[model samples]
Target: MQAKEELQTHARSSPAVFGYPRGRDRRGLRFVISVSLQLDSQGCLRRLQSTGHAVGPQGGNTVCAAATALMRSASRALADHSSIVISGHAPREGVLEIEVLQCGAEYHAYLRGVTDVLLRGLKDLALDEPSEVTIRQS
Candidate 1:
């Protein structure tokens, strides 16, 4: 299939799903990173979302805090880019969902980098505490 067709196919498929167990608590860090990227289309990033629930025991709270901070950081990265529409919400307990719609051509690299960093952070966290954290990708 052509590149555009392949991108459309990926967009239709289930997003890259990920979840990590929270430390000392079963409620570990969980999130979904999904993006519908297209170059020739009207926009560069058709959809971008990072959403998850982070809440457990005291240790879990720390993990959740880190997760939410990352989310906010990513949000700030795109704050001034007017071509993109961004929305994010987090409860005091640490449930966060950040969505960026219609990402433009200029910030494509920035968004990709942010996504990579987030994934790496989660993977490293899970590795450090195997028993307390679990990571799944599909």
Candidate 2:
């Protein structure tokens, strides 16, 4: 079997930290929590935004610094960038939950952000960075 397939199998069999059980619900598993100092496409100082991340001209240097910092911290934490999972939802006020999968295969880091961040109404958590990285699904 392919390496990706193998990993997927492992994840499914193993209980996920967040979201419904893999066997019970696969379709809802698409959601994720991605955090980077990177600016949203519309671009400004957005601390937390969901998939479809947009970095505009105003994205500025701070964004780079923030994202770089996040990357550095995360890389150090896991020692592997690809396996990192940036979570967006917080179960409480100014608090977040991060669940790094077994063997450090997946790293999820959660942080508190604005309503836009929670407006997406998360149902699951993905370790991978979202393509768009929007707080909510359009």
Candidate 3:
């Protein structure tokens, strides 16, 4: 119960999906530090999203669905060699303002899994498209 509450707290306090707030600047540099891994877990990750103030009832559910989709896609592409599990807090202005962490022992496998999906994701993104994906806006 305590863990569940903490999860809810984090979700509630997290920034919106990816939209420029009224007072915040959109063109800002983000802080991120990443390390290479050889035995990482396989999975896809998404930033915690925020739009208005509340994360809403489906916030967690939506994130879970996205994670599952990414993992399934990546896993199928790579067979059973590796898998990915991603988690992060969405930013207020940028698409995803956070350092990506690759968890698990098969770090290398995880890295490849993430990379495979990332390349595909980048291809799917367009420069003109806004990063914001909020409940209200969606």
Candidate 4:
């Protein structure tokens, strides 16, 4: 009887066990990745930013990985292009920002192609994981 009482007391004091209300625990929360795009007047992508983490299992998160890969690939491609002047950085974990400083008119078509592919990949990922990813454009 005393052991049973002690067990009940322990459970009451332990948040991991019984203290959190149903559906209100931290484990029940969903982490969302937010991707933002800034477009120039000509409808060209001028900037991109991504923040947040899509929490998943112990090994890795497929949604977050896919989003990060797409953004990084786009940034690298733009930076490597001779006609595009770009700056990019990962300010912190799970955050990335890239801005286009200048671009030669001759290479605008190449920029458009890269931007289109990045945007398409991100949109597809968002569609597949509606609860884990979000996209905003400005």
Which portions of model 4 show Cα errors greater than 4 Å? 1-30
Worst 10 residues of 3 by lDDT: 31-40
TM-score, predicted candidate 3 vs. hidden true structure: 0.26
The TM-score that candidate 2 achieves is: 0.21
Comparing 3 and 4 on lDDT, the stronger one: 4
State the lDDT at 61 in candidate 1: 38
Runs in model 3 lying further than 4 Å from the true structure: 1-87, 93-95, 127-138
Error of 2 at 3 (Å): 52
Maximum-TM-score candidate: 4
**Per-residue C-alpha lDDT of model 3 across residues 1-138, encoded as one tens digit per residue:** 999997767554423433434423244422111112122133333222222221223335344335334434543434334333444444442233222343455555555555556444432321222232222110
Q: How many residue pairs clash (N, CA or C atoms closer than 3 angstroms) in each of the candidate models, in the order given?
A: 3, 16, 24, 0
**Candidate 4: TM-score?**
0.75
How does candidate 2 score on lDDT? 0.32
lDDT of each: 0.47, 0.32, 0.36, 0.77
Clashes of 4: 0
Model 2: CA > 4 A from native: 1-54, 80-99, 103-138
Error of 1 at 113 (Å): 1.2
Q: Quick one: RMSD of model 4?
A: 9.5
Estimate, for each residue in 1-138, the C-alpha lDDT of model 2 and write its tens digit: 698786555443322432345322233322222443333343222343322212221132232234334433533444344544334344432223333332221322322222224322321222122331223332
